[model samples]
Target: MFAPGQEQLSKEQIKAGEIQASQTVRSAVAGAIMLYLSPFAVDFVKKFL
Candidate 1:
């Protein structure tokens, strides 16, 4: 995508971006999983309280 005068990301910068994206995806997945399991948490709390 880089043309003659356009700025391009260095290899380290590209890797860092990829890592950040991966972490973001993982965090989203974890949040969704927690949401899906939230009912169980409520149930567990009810059992003790």
Candidate 2:
């Protein structure tokens, strides 16, 4: 009865948490890639300009 409703709520909460964790990881990876590549990009531009 009421137990099923509570269980569904818990499941939804777990899914939301997982989605948030994935987004955070993706952002961190994107930031790291940008950080690593930015210096090379600047040097390349400087050579042309």
Candidate 3:
């Protein structure tokens, strides 16, 4: 028979994996947005200083 604790542990592991995957996707999107916007930001800052 499977141990009682094993099922809970497996569920926790699946939840953790989903959280990690979502974070990874969010980071990728943020990075891409920053990459696309950086040039305009740099020019804007340069105009002030």
Where does candidate 3 stray beyond 4 Å? 1-9
The models' CA-based lDDT, in order, is: 0.97, 0.90, 0.91
- Tens digits of per-residue lDDT for model 3, 1-49: 2776554447788899999999999999999999999999999999999
The TM-score obtained by model 1 is: 0.80
Which portions of model 2 miss their true places by more than 4 Å? 1-9
For model 1, the superposed segments whose C-alpha errors exceed 4 Å read 2-4
Please provide TM-scores, in order, for all candidate models, with all chains considered together.
0.80, 0.78, 0.74
Question: Taking the tens digit of each residue's C-alpha lDDT, what string does model 1 give over 1-49?
Answer: 6588888889999999999999999999999999999999999999999
Name the lDDT value of residue 18 in candidate 2. Answer: 96
Best by TM-score: 1
Q: On lDDT, who's better, 1 or 3? A: 1
Q: Give me the displacement of residue 42 in model 1, in angstroms.
A: 0.1
By lDDT rank, best first, the candidates go 1, 3, 2
Per-residue lDDT of 1-23 in model 2, one digit per residue for the tens? 36655534477888999999999
